[model samples]
Target: MLQSVELASTSADVLIMAAAVSDWKPSDVSQQKIKKDG
Candidate 1:
């Protein structure tokens, strides 16, 4: 969130940021589909 605010404060006309966020994967890969609680 701080990064986003700092980005807007940038004086540069062209800002190129290649920020990559990795997805959170389960500890184990299950062949069966996971169930959700109601």
Candidate 2:
């Protein structure tokens, strides 16, 4: 994402981001890989 933003700044005059960001931290993180259930 950093590389993308840096590259875009060269050609574009302005950059507008409309993505939503989470302010809160997660309580628990899973160490194991999540399996896709089919």
Model 1, span 1-38: residue lDDT tens: 77886878687777555654664566899899989999
- Judge candidate 1 at residue 9 and give its lDDT: 60
Q: For candidate 2, give the lDDT of residue 11.
A: 88
Best by TM-score: 2
lDDT of each residue in 1-38, candidate 2, tens digit only: 88989987988988887755675566887899879999
Stretches of candidate 2 exceeding 4 Å from the true structure: 21-38
Which candidate leads the pack in lDDT?
2
Each model's TM-score, in the order given?
0.27, 0.39
Cα lDDT, model 1, residue 38: 100
Whole-model lDDT values for every prediction:
0.73, 0.81
